[model samples]
Each structure stands twice: as structure tokens, then as C-alpha cells.
Target chain A: MLIPFIFISACGADNANESEWRTLDLNNTVLLTLPQGKVVIELAPQFSPKHVEQFSSLVQKSFYDGTKFYRVIDGFVAQGGPKDGSEQDKSVPLLAMEGQFSTDGKAPFTLVQRDDLFAKKTGFKEGFAVATNNSKSGWLTHCPGVLAMARSNEADSASSHFYFVIGQAPRYLDKIMTIFGRVVYGMNHIQAIQRTTVIDGEYAVDSREHTPIISMKLMADVPKKDRIIIEVENTESASFAERLVKRRARASEFFYKKPPPVLDVCQVPIRSRLVKLQD
Target chain B: MLIPFIFISACGADNANESEWRTLDLNNTVLLTLPQGKVVIELAPQFSPKHVEQFSSLVQKSFYDGTKFYRVIDGFVAQGGPKDGSEQDKSVPLLAMEGQFSTDGKAPFTLVQRDDLFAKKTGFKEGFAVATNNSKSGWLTHCPGVLAMARSNEADSASSHFYFVIGQAPRYLDKIMTIFGRVVYGMNHIQAIQRTTVIDGEYAVDSREHTPIISMKLMADVPKKDRIIIEVENTESASFAERLVKRRARASEFFYKKPPPVLDVCQVPIRSRLVKLQD
Candidate 1:
């Protein structure tokens, strides 16, 4: 069962050092080729060791080059890592869910929130789903664009199947799964697809249907000129904090409604600029 | 402008009452047919009057039959109400943004989460974009799955163009545009669509080169058995309170770190179940 986590802090365009903005490293990026467009995700090796290890190794081996984001729950998540591939891919045994989140140490851009007071828990933000609790330290945070391994009913069931948080923070799925990285760009590409009715036959279908994923690739594999340049607003920048606070406080003339005093970490509007890198 | 309002409520399902279950009126349900599958959207007249008038009238006239959910934002929204239509239907005169949320003494749900505490907005639950400040009044609520009118940057620019919330709640767009209705069923269908990207240009280029929606339609206009069946869990249920509290608890094995103790209405999950009506 997925548990919804409170957004830690959402401050967009609020803070910025003089030179905080930077472009993505395409050499280390993976291109999620969807039917509509290609989604470029820059993995984070700085967060977790084991989690990133599995992700990098798999991506290098072309593990998710063709998997589809099969399950998409609005205000929640869009999952893609697929084990439903070739006989060999499926033949590879799934890995146990990595427990990386720990609550002991302090990290950057990290804030902690819990529904109940007694329930002591905290972690860093990978994006939205990859979180780490110091109680037993690892890496993973549930922020938008954060990617994690998808699993079934068991905590140890996570594998190549991965997903993205496209909605509110579903922190409930936290300790139970392994979250690895986040999408620094191309989130809109995944956000704007059409949907399908319940696969459940007549609202109560039988067996699961085998969905097909055509192809996926890494930008590094493509020619440098072919790459689309993109840059994300630095998280620690004052501008990002300002943008978020203004958004949470109400900036548009259309919003006659006064919003709550705070913003959810998942609700933060992180901006990404199209970096036109010329030859 | 699009505003997302993701609400996260605790399940507290233990206190849920069977009596709270309410079936949707078949006559009022709109079945959306797409190549992917069938989507059922129940328009709520309780939210917006002016927008619903134009919407239902359009549905009856088959305005959206061949329309597609043009722009989809993966965890945010799937918008398809476009003023631009195919040669067959042609575009209809856009509807002006009617500030009707200022209604006095609106229908009351057992659960009370005051908008005055947050934003002064409300909308049609069946099929309308409404806004309201229960204390002051009511109109369009940016809850998830809501089908709203799409307009230009102008205040009253929304014509027949519309969109649906597929991901996080975009509350920033509230009150600026007119919300027509919401999708009550088969949200998964619209949520599963693959997102599109810019093909011709490298950066933000011509808007037309952007992905275009194929078409959209009401399911009632399609095959009989293909219609998707859905059941929305009562938000006012006892389980809701529990879910609300637990959701805030953030007690999990994975959270190596936790943010803080905070919760927002938009972060809440709107529970649902699939059911096929017996002939």
C-alpha cells in the first residue's frame, strides 16, 4: 500500500547563489523514448550508492531502453521499469528492495515532516520517491521527477521496473521500495499523455495483459549534436525559493483564492530552461 | 495557466460507512472513447453552471466525439478541450469565465475542509469548473480529474477547449479560467497515455510542431459493453480521516530521512474502485 507523505518545503526561486544554474551532463543522461517524445533523465549518483549502482549498471546494459510507464496514477505516480520483457530479462531474478533511507545525518535541501508526532522519520530528496531514513541509512527521496524501483506486495520485490512521481508525494510507498534518481528535464513529455480505461475486463478483468514497450535509449549513445540542451534551476538558489513561495502564496491574478501558508515539497515549481548549446 | 490542487487525506477506513456510497446517475455519465480504451467521465452540475451549459450542449451535439485529449502533463493533467476542432465539428464560440463560485449556501458534504482557510474556490463535482469560498461563497475547485474549459491568456478566453488533471494539482491557474467539469471515472485511461515531445525543433520552437491531441468522445456515444465502470470512494468516509492522519504519519521502513509535519488538501488521494453495471 502506498502512503502519502507530507511535502517538506516548497520554495521556488527563493534562493540562489550568484552562479547556481548549470546545464545537465548529457554523457551521464538516459533518454526515455516514449511514443510521443523522448524524456531525458539525469541520474543522481550523489544520493545513494547501492540504489544508483543498480540503476547505472542496468541502464548501461540497456535494461530500460524499451520499457513502458505502464501504471500512471494522477496526483501520485507514473511507473515504467518493466520486468515483463524478454525471457532472459525476466529470467534475471529480481533484487530485494534496498533500504537506504536513514534519519541520523543532515543533508542538503532536506526537510522532515510526518503525519503523527511519535512517528519519527526523515530522509533526503532524490526528487520525490527515493528517500532515506537515518534509522537505517541509505538514499532516496520522494520529490517530483524522482525515479524508483517498482515492486509488488513485498518489500524485497523491487527490480528493473521503475516509476516516476507525477502527482502528489506518495510517501507511503517509501521504506518498502527502492528509489534511485530524478528527471532534471523533460517531465512535461511524460506528463502530457492520454490514458486508457481500467484494464480490468468489464471492471473485473482476468489475466494481466502483456503491454509492449517499443524502444528506449541513452542520450550519450546519440550524437552530441542530436542532443537537446536543457538546464534546471538550482535547488538551493534564492530564485527557486522565491518562485515557490510566491506560487504557494499566490502570484497570478487569476487566483482570487488565498492558498495555505505553506507549500508541499512535491508541489514546488522547479523551473528548467532550455539550454541551446551551440557548436 | 493551470493550477493543481492535490489533496492527501488519511484512509482511517475503519470508520467508513457503507451508507455513504452513492452510485452515479447513468443518464448523467459521459463515456469517453479513445483508441486506447474507453473513459467514463461524470460531469458535475453542482460546480459550474455556465461552463456545464456549454459542455453538455456540446456533448449532445457531438462536439467532443472526435476530439482528442491534446495536451497531457503526466502527473498533473490531461487537457483536451480545445477551441480548435476538426473540419467535421468546427470550433464553437468560447465560453466566458463566469465567476459563479460566489454562490450562497451551497450543497454541503459531511466532510468539511474550509476553502476560506486555503483558497476561496469551488466547482461542479459532476461536470463543471466552479469556484467558491464557502465562508464567502463558491466556484471552481482545482481537484484532480476535473474537466475544465481551456482559454487563452485572457480572463474569459476559454472556449470549447478543455483539459483534465492527470498529475499534481496545479492550483496556480485557479479563478483565472473557467472550469467546466471533471472526469469521475476511468482516470487511469487518460493517465496511461504516452506523452509527446517536440520533433522538428531542438528547443521551444513552433507551438504547432508540438504534440497535437488525436480526438476525444463521450463513452455513452460508443459501444455498450465497452463502457468503463467506476466507483469513487466517499471522501467523507471514516476511512478518509484515518487515511488523512496516517498519510501524514509518514511511518515507513524506507524513509531514511523525514521532512517535517505538514499536510495539504491537494496532497490527499481521491479513492476509487472499478465496477461494471449489470445489464
Candidate 2:
């Protein structure tokens, strides 16, 4: 009775060619330094240009320095930003909603599931999980590690406050929230962020328990000697396509009961690696 | 530009009658005490009889006391048990696989989604998320807080070690693994458990970083003064059905961009509350 717990083998990237990987752009990459570790985020400026621009400008200005993850709901999201009613906060303008955008059939979309519960189709595009309706319009799915803007009751009211999907994929918030980026590396640190303990159905608002954000800076702003180089598997590459096929097939001997030959967009592992440029 | 974040209002349990809730039976309840807090688990003996019996017997003998959650993978599972190859550990019998069970149409099921990616139908039964193949055979889904048995490559090798789904629902393992119970209360404590940091694609195997389990006990064996009363919303109740309808509708004013009129089985909330019997 040898009970050796086994995990499904992750797709190997060792055999992948250099063309299968794409180095993250310094202009769009953000280095979010928390108390635990550095969380690397890659912004999708092509999808939500305004939101990415706003977030990048804030990073450049050190607007997120000394902020706290104020509202963290377990199995839902971890939202954080400067909530102080300062003059700078008052000056930030509210941008119009960019929840979903119309897409041509030309985007490098790799299909994962044709029959998703929330949309007509679900897949990955530019390393982001996406859902589309009739291949005409698409929006990023609310998978774990997704970075989206938080808003009030009004639709077009997202400003500086942002949230990370830290648990199960809240697909209900798919087309409603504006998703602009995702954590390409150090998702473990995001999960390790201290959660706000809700006592008797009431959220603890005493910010003392919240995890602090030491600083957030764009990779371009960081000194050349201190940057961590990140490279992600290109979703459009042939090697990635092959890996997706292998995942859907589950051809390993470990699986005594083969699962359905359908892949959830969130389950698709977009592999990434971090290289420290200097000591 | 007031960025006030708003959350979807949870289904109200205040208006429901007492009949709509089901008080858990003490015989099948387990209280797993961790350093952070106590987690209340409701075992489903009807699904996996052998596994439940084995687990109950172990709880009575304090087999899980002082065990460390050695393999806590972020966004995956927290696997832990006494791996210290003692004579008692070698004496445990290997149990046959009870991954799924046949079902008649008589089971009290509340339909949540008709089109799930992995199953023909998905819904809730006896307060647990379930997926069925043509309403004939069903298995528990691997949603967050689900307690399941861990085994090796061989299907029927599970004995003493167990794991809990701590993050996104891994639907692929739904039918392959045997799910015996779910965390009905204090899931926050489960989410707050220390995670094993994987450095450079290698998992840290140090035992010191793992969270230690204080003890596990059956609620029935505990004295009346120490028991915590747990009541879960009945999935078969009319109020719960109505709540599911409201969740699918997104009729609240807060949702300016109403989501699709479909629900993911994992997104449905099965509310529970804890009542301390003594101070």
C-alpha cells in the first residue's frame, strides 16, 4: 500500500526553440515589490490602452508606493490601491469602459474550448485567457492571476484602484470588469499576501492587517543592474500549440481515467521564466 | 472620480425559513484544528463509504494529530499526512477506488448549469458541487475547499494521505480522484495556510516551513461544551433554488454590464455559518 501522491507532469519547455518564447517588453512590464517578494506583471496595452496607460503612468509617478491591499476576499479577489482622499487621487480622471473589444478573425487566437459556459468560445490570445462571442467580440476571462480595474456601480468609472483574481476563475465578472494585465511570474507571492479576515460576515477594515506594497515601478524605470528578465511562451508558437494538444489528449500513463478532451482556458499553463540580470 | 468598489450582494439567508437549512449530523462531521483556526468538514459517507469509515476510524485514534501539511502547492492542493513510515502506518489497508457512483433521478439536485465543459450536466447535491453524465452517474467536483483522497499512479493506492483543493477548481481530476468531504466552515483558514515556495522550478521540501496540524476530532466524540454547531443551506430547498435563479439573472443594479444568463457550478455559493457552543 504505497501511497505516493503524484501530480500531472507539467508540459516541458526544455525542447522548445528560442522562437517559441518572447521576451517581455520593458515599457509594459511592471515590477511590483511587496513585502514578500517581487511580482512581475505584463500589461496588455493592445487590449485596454487607456487602462494600461493610466497604470503605467501611476507606476512611473510612484503612486502605488506604501499602498495596502484593503479588500481581499478569499476565493475571489485581492484589490489594492491608494484609498486616501488626497488631492492627487482626486485629480485622476475616470476612463470610459474598455471591457470588451470587437475583434477580427486575424488575432493569433489559439482555441481551447469551443463550448464555454460564459461565452461562445474560450481561448488564449497574447498570453491572456480570452472569451469571444461568434468570433466578433472578445474579452479577457477572469482567471486567477488576472489584473483588472475595480469600479463602482457605474460602468465607466474605473480609475486607479485595481484588483487581482487570486482564487477560482470568477467568470461571472468576465465582460463586466476591464482586464488589462496578468501576473507572468511570482503568483505564489500574490497568493501569500495576507488576507483580510472577515469576522462574523463583517470585513476587517483596520488596515493594520493588510499586506503592504513597498513600491511599484515599470521595468524601464528600474536601473539596468536591478531588473529581472522575464520571457513567456508565445501562445501563437507551434511548440505551444503542440503542448496544448498534448494537454488535451492527456496521453500520460499516470491517467488511469482519461478526462474529456476539452481544455479550459484557465487551465492552459502559459509558461514563464525569470532570469536575474545581476547579483 | 470617486473609485468606490462594489461587490455583488450575496444571497440573503435571513428571509429563509428554518426548514431550508440542514443541521449537519455529528457522526459524519470532523473538526480539523490548524494553527490559524478550526475547519469544519462535513463528510459524505453516502458517496465514499470506505474512505469515510477509514477517515473516521483514524480521527478517533488521533492519527492526524501533529501532522504537517508538507506539500502545500499554491493554487493547487494542500496534501498532508503522517509520512513517518511507522509500524502503525504500514498496517493500514489499501482501499478500492470509489471515484464515482451511480445515481437515480431521485437524488435532490438543484441544477446550476446545463452545459459544463467536463460533464454532461453540473449542479449541487447535498450541499456539494457535482457533475453528472446524463443524470445516471455523478462525482464531486474539485472546487476550492473540497477534501479528496490522494493516490499514486495506480488508481486504488490511496490509504492515509489526503489533500484539499485550495485554489481554482481542477475539473480534470473530478472523476479520477475520490472526494469524500468539503470544508463547510472556516475556509479562510485553509486559504491562509502556509504555501510551499518553489524556487527555480523546484519545490522546497523543508518540513519547518510547513503548517502543523494540532489535532483532528469527530464532533460527536467532543464534549457538548466544545462542539460547534454547523448549519448548511439545503440545495433541495425552494429558497436555494430561487437564490440560484437570482444569481443567474444578475438583475441587481450594481451590474451595469449584465453577465451572461448562465452560471458556473463552482461560482454558486453554498452558505454556511458557525455557532460556538461555548465561550
Candidate 3:
């Protein structure tokens, strides 16, 4: 949906100016350079270490470059990777389920709510949306922009194909798909990919509609001058907590009346912005 | 975002076979015949009476005949109405804020959750998502496929433009926008509209991408022979509650592990299907 341009621009500026933010480690970041722009994704190894490792390895091997977003369901997910199954390397063993919560839950954990309807507890761990029944382990959520491995009916089938949440949080898929990362920048570019019409139950994007992945490179591989430095709001910080409260009971000038007094973690603003590295 | 075809087709069949359902009132229904197919929207006058009246009146007058979905944000909303503001008929007075809870403790209300994060109480009333702080009144929610009146910053400026939520349940818009109806049939048709790309901070759709509205007419206005009969699942039914439980702890064959133990109101399926009206 077309959000009011003013609202988005204002939010973008506010996020760019956040006082307390953490720069994403280059080793854990990947850049997807599309025709529209570059999208930077931060891999969450703490949640899905194996999936992260495999995804990064694939990136370094240039597995996804030139791949097309084969299946994009409006308000659902943008799935891209190998579609013909020709790229499947049988040697890359299929990974077991890595979707369930498995975090240390120590620092950088900002508990959003304790009584979340979707889980025993819901919060942000490190820089990703998380939900779990215990502090020992939690799964990454399916919020918009989340990167998750797509699998068939088999639990161990997730190997190459990955889908990104582009709509409402499909919490039902929380423990079913391995969420590995999130797009932190150039979401607009991703959102701008032209919709491909489905025909006779077949998801076929015409050659003209294909949004080609120009390249997928880990930040560490990019030259220092070419790398786009970014910092995400420390989700566990006090400022973030304050911001979450304000969003839940928004008293903004445009709001006719105060909205609901609570917010889902997805509704909370976890901002990311490009930053120039200090020389 | 694209969904697995098998999963979607399976869900489609399940939704189409609801045993206990309610046929939409012709007087309170509007059909949007597009290039792809027809979308049936059930108007909720009880929620926003004035907005519904105005919208239906505009439909009857053929105000939306050739309009295009001007602004469509993937995983957000699809907004469409008169763009040129030249169609404004001064006779139609501007609508006041009719967007808050206005119902009494009611029988049709199936309370989904008492501790809803978005509101004091949340549930479904007459097959539409509703939320209220008190037992006396509740407003329609911004669930997927919800039809809402859009306006500028002014609360009372809602006149012509309207939008359909095609993504996540944006609860932040709950008491803010006037949600007057919902799409009860042909959601797939609505979801099929090609997404317009955002260029230079503006929503732009190439002529090739535009999904033109062939016509929009109230069901009452359509000839009896041409009417497309459809029925939506009764939200207040016991079967719906059972379905909600199954969704929360989904043990389906596809699920690697059972997901969370709770269901958000939007997560619960409200099925709709084609039906033949007994002569």
C-alpha cells in the first residue's frame, strides 16, 4: 500500500538520526544488488546458525546471482532462488529444522510483551523479532522483510530457496520455516518489483517482469569504499522501549483518536539506516 | 510474495466448503467487476453508517466505473477512487468521524480475545473484525481485505477515496480510519491486481500495469440473473472457534513442529464461497 510519502520520509530521517545504534558486522551481512537498488540483509546466526552459514556460503559462491524472484504473492512473500532445481547440489546436505527458538537470551534482548497471543513470550533478540516459551531458545518471527528458507512438506527440505515476508506476519509459519535474516535497507526497491500475474495455478513471471538479482555478495567481500555501512537501532535499548510505548498509543497530529493501547512486535519500529563509517 | 500453490489451493477448497455460512445481503453488497474478475464487498453500515451510505451511493451513481487502483503497496494496501478530485459533488456533504466503537453488548459478537494487544477487547461482529474497549460499542478492524475510507490529515475529509487492506492487520489504523466494509468474495481477484511501482516518492502505474475497474455496482442494482451468489462463514459459529484452536497449535502434515499456542483475530480464517440461491 502506498503510505503517505511524508510519513515515510519523516520516519526515515528519524531512524537515520538515532542516537544509540549498532553497526552491522560485515562478516554477518549480505548485499543483494537488484535493478531497483541494493538491499542489505543482516544474518542472524544466533537463531539459525546452520542456515545462516549455508546462505552466506551460497552467497560467496555466487549461487543466487542472476536468479529470478520466481514466486511473488502480493501481500504474502517474495520467494527467490533456484526454481528449475538444476542448481541443487546434492552434496550440500539438507539441514534439519532450525526454526524453533534457540537463543541464549542474554544481552540485547528487549522484551516487547509477556502476554503475546502467539507465544509464551515475544520480544526482540539481537536485532530480529523473536518469540519463545522460554529464555533458553526462541524462533525468529515471520515479520515483513524477514528472510526464511522455503521448504516442501519435508522438514529437512529447506536447502536453497528462500522467501522474504512482504506482508502481514504469518506467525503460523514461525516454527515451520527457518528464518535466517532480514532486509535492513532498500526495502522500497524490493517492494517496487512489478507484480507477476499467475496463470492456471502456475506462478510464471514473464521474462519482461523478472527482477534479476544482479549480484549477492557478503559485506566482507565488498571493498571497504564500496560497502554501504548501516546501523540498526539497538532493539534492547531503553529508547526503543519508549518508542514502542508511544507507537502503541499514538497521539500524532494525523491520528483522529488514540489508537489501541498495545502493539504487536511487528508494529513496533525497529529502524535501520545508512551511516558513514568514521575514518 | 508468492505462496505455495498447493497450500493456497487446499485452503481455497476448505474455505469454499464452510457448512454454516451467511449469504450477504444484496442491499448491503457491492460488486467490483475488474479485468481479472469480480470482487464482492459486504458493507458494514453498523460500523460506519455514514461512510457506508456515501460509498454505496457513489457506487450506485457509477462514480468508480473506470477508476484505477492508483496506489498499491505490496504487503500494505490497494487504494483507489477518483484521483482528479474533479468528480466532487458539492451536494454530498463531507463525512464526520464515524470510525469509533458504536455497538452495544451484542449476540452476534464472538469475542476472540479479551486481552487483545490492539484494543481493550477484540472479536468478530457479523462476520467483520471488530474491537472495543467497552461492551456497548466496537469498531471494524483493519484486517486483510477490509474496505476503509481514506483521507488526508483531516479526520472529516473522508469523502471519495477508499482502500483495501491486502497485507498484515495494521492495527495502528484501527480507530483512525473509517473501516466500513470487507471483501466477502473474490479475494483472489483483488489480490491479483498488479502492484504499481513507486517512482520518485510517487505511486506510478504504467498503462500496461493498470488494473481498470470495469464497473462497480451494488448487488441490488445488478439484475437478478447476473448476480453472483456467495456466502461467508458465520463468524459467531462454534465451528469457527474450533478452527481457531486448530490454527493456534497447528499439527498439519506440512508443519515441521506445532506452531504457537495462540491465534490473533486476523489469523483465524473467515471463509467465503460461491453458492446458488434457491429459486
Rank order (by TM-score, best first): 2, 3, 1
Better of 1 and 2 by lDDT: 2
lDDT of 2 at B214: 93
Model 1 Cα displacement at A193 (Å)? 8.9
In order of appearance, the predictions have TM-scores of 0.66, 0.88, 0.72
Model 2: CA > 4 A from native = A1-18, A84-88, A197-205, A224-226, A277-279, B1-18, B84-89, B197-205, B223-226, B277-279
Q: Largest TM-score belongs to which candidate?
A: 2
| Per-residue lDDT of model 2, residues B98-151, tens digit only | 889778755536778886788777888889999887757888899989999888
lDDT per residue as tens, model 1, B135-230:
546556565676777666566666677777665566555666556555665555566554433322244344444334333445555466855566
DockQ score of the complex predicted as candidate 2: 0.39
Model 3 RMSD in Å is 10.1
Measured as a fraction from 0 to 1, the native contacts recovered by model 2 come to 0.54
TM-score of each model's B chain?
Answer: 0.68, 0.89, 0.83
Ranking by DockQ: 2, 3, 1
Candidates by lDDT, descending order: 2, 3, 1
Residues B115-178, candidate 3, lDDT per residue (tens digit)?
6677766778778888777767777888888999888788898888888987678878877789
Query: What CAPRI-style quality would you assign to candidate 3?
Result: acceptable
Evaluate model 2: give its lDDT: 0.82
